[model samples]
Target: MPPTLQSLDHLVLTVSDVDATLAFYRDVLGMVPQSFTPTGGTARWALTFGCQKINLHRAGHEFEPKAKMPRAGSADLCFLSDTPLDAWQATLAVHGVLVEEGPIRRTGAQGPILSIYLRDPDGNLIEISNQI
Candidate 1:
């Protein structure tokens, strides 16, 4: 059998502008932010929610050799939120982030989820969902 996996720890996102990405996630979506310089490398920022986090690496300066084909707008990710879908949309509006699409039905890892889709500054698709 393949090795069993636990929860996700972190994911790396190559971004065109780290500051913009950080602001969108931290201010618009409410992720906790942390900045660090590992060992003796360039600085990086991470936006965390729940127990998982996304590390921002500038497009040209990733830590070591990274993803086989990493690009600024390459990821499409989904997240679970306890807030109602309508409230989530309102929050996005307050932050001036446009809704790409949703509040639609979707399936999640746990079960049925009500999801709202939005795009990050890098154009990465983000789905914010709640259990239904």
Candidate 2:
């Protein structure tokens, strides 16, 4: 039988500047930034939120076994937030993040969701949504 997917564990993001990307996710999106080293390996960075995480690889210095076309500013990711849309607007305002589009109705994986779209430091599209 073919395998079925259950849930997402993590994903990788290619970034231009690690510090800027880390700062945006950490300060603007409330994700926890972490740094760790593999056994006999170099340091790596990740951003954690809830049960998921995003591993970071520098654009010109990606680790081994990476994407065939690893490029910065190439990802579009959506995140589900329990926080209200109004609150999210305020938070974005406080952070000076420009809204590319949204606080509009959209279809989500489970159901309808209200979403707001913006760009991260690496110009990756970021969508923050709340189930309605």
Candidate 3:
């Protein structure tokens, strides 16, 4: 029998500008930013949302033994939002983040969802959605 995984823990991403990435995720997206020192005694930054987190590595400074071909703009991620889709659109508007595509009906793993898409500074596609 195969071992069953529990829930997603965290994921890593490479970014050209750590400051911009942190600001976008912290101020615009409302994720909490945190810093820590890894085993090598170097402080690193990450954003946390509930039980999950996203660790960011500066482009050209990724940790060793990572993905064979890690690169910025290669990540496309979705986040579940409890807020109404319209409210999300408004919040995004406040941040001057244009909706690349959005308010479109889509099927989530749980069922139907209303989703909107945006791109981060590194051009990573981010999908935010709410279940109906």
Candidate 4:
């Protein structure tokens, strides 16, 4: 049988500004920031939460083996949160991240979820949701 995939381990996000992307994910979304330096390679950053991570790559300086057309503001990502949607709204308000749309019902990997949509500094569409 072909090898079966179990779950997502990580993904890469190409952005114009790494620091701004790091700030949005780390401060606004509450993800932890990690820095690593591969042997003989430039330093890199990733945002980690709940056993998953998103690696950040500067748009014109992406590492090898990347997407055919890696570009900033082109990704749409959904993240699950145990925090209630209302509370999420409050947090977003505090951070000044506008809600593009949501608090609407949507399907998640586990089940039905209530979600809120926003955009990151790089204009990546972000969906934060809680199981309903």
Candidate 5:
């Protein structure tokens, strides 16, 4: 028998304001709201960009609040695209999203890769990378 493997399901983030976070994800990154739920004093929102899903949960519930701003950039939720690197860079720039660094050419084990990085409204790092 072979082990089964599947695609990434979703990512959840603890946010300060659900509405503001939704707006940022929807308006800025072009994610669409999938659904929302409110129970007791807590709320959760599900958003989708293509097949990727991200859920936002309000901070300060059972979970500890996220660390103060200027957080250490230890994590990232990257987005991958089949689009050419130059076209993706131009599209991102047209939307006023700043690219922190490269589309620099680098060699991957397979061949070559091009990548760029940015941050979301909540300061989470985002990477857009593709193999060339």
Candidate 6:
């Protein structure tokens, strides 16, 4: 027998403000809020976009105080979209999301691809890439 693999289940990110992060993911990214809870005085919000579920957990308390700035170019998670590169870029721009640079051409394991990268409010990198 061989080890079988399943699809990605979720991506969790620690945020300074859960409400604001939820708004960005929901309002800007057009994801839907799936659930939220306050555990031990910190809020946890879950959102769904397409098949991906993103969990935002509030950080700032005795157990989980604020963290240092994340490493530049470090992605908490990367999301792929079937939407055209230009359209996605325009959409991000409209939401005031700054593009660090790209839609650059590159060769991937699967073949050629185009990608653009940006950062969220918490300084988490997000790359929007598509096969070219």
- Per-residue CA lDDT of model 2 for 41-98, tens digit only, reads 8999999999999999999899888999999999999899999988988999999999
Clashes of 1: 0
lDDT of 1: 0.89
lDDT of 1 by residue, 1-132 (tens): 999988789999999998888888888888998988888787778998888888888998778769987899989999998889889888889888888888799999989998999999999999999998
Please write out the lDDT profile of model 3 over residues 17-54, one tens digit for every residue. Answer: 99999999998889999998889768999999999999
Question: How much is 72 displaced in model 1, in angstroms?
Answer: 0.6
User: Which one is best on TM-score?
Assistant: 2
Which window of 10 residues has the lowest lDDT sum in candidate 6? Answer: 61-70
Q: Enumerate clash totals for all models, in the order shown.
A: 0, 0, 0, 0, 0, 1
C-alpha lDDT of candidate 2 relative to the true structure: 0.94
**Root-mean-square deviation per candidate:** 1.3, 0.9, 1.0, 1.0, 4.6, 4.2
Which consecutive 10 residues in model 5 have the weakest lDDT in total? 62-71
Q: What lDDT tens digits, residue by residue, belong to model 6 across residues 94-128? A: 99988898988766557777888788778887777
Candidate 2 Cα errors over 4 Å, as ranges: none
Q: How well does candidate 1 match the true structure in TM-score terms?
A: 0.93
User: What 10-residue stretch in candidate 2 is worst by lDDT?
Assistant: 33-42
| Model 3 regions lying over 4 Å from their true place | none
Query: Hey, what RMSD does candidate 3 come out at?
Result: 1.0
Screening candidate 1 with a backbone cut-off below 3 angstroms (N, C-alpha, C), the clashing residue pairs are none
Per-model lDDT: 0.89, 0.94, 0.91, 0.92, 0.69, 0.71
Clashing pairs in 2: none
> Arrange candidates by TM-score, highest first: which order?
2, 4, 3, 1, 6, 5
Models 1 onward score TM values of: 0.93, 0.96, 0.95, 0.96, 0.68, 0.75
- Candidate 4 residue-wise lDDT, 1-132, digit = tens: 999999999999999999998888989899999998878888899999999999989999999879999999999999999888889899999999999999999999888999999999988899999888
> Cα lDDT of model 4 overall?
0.92
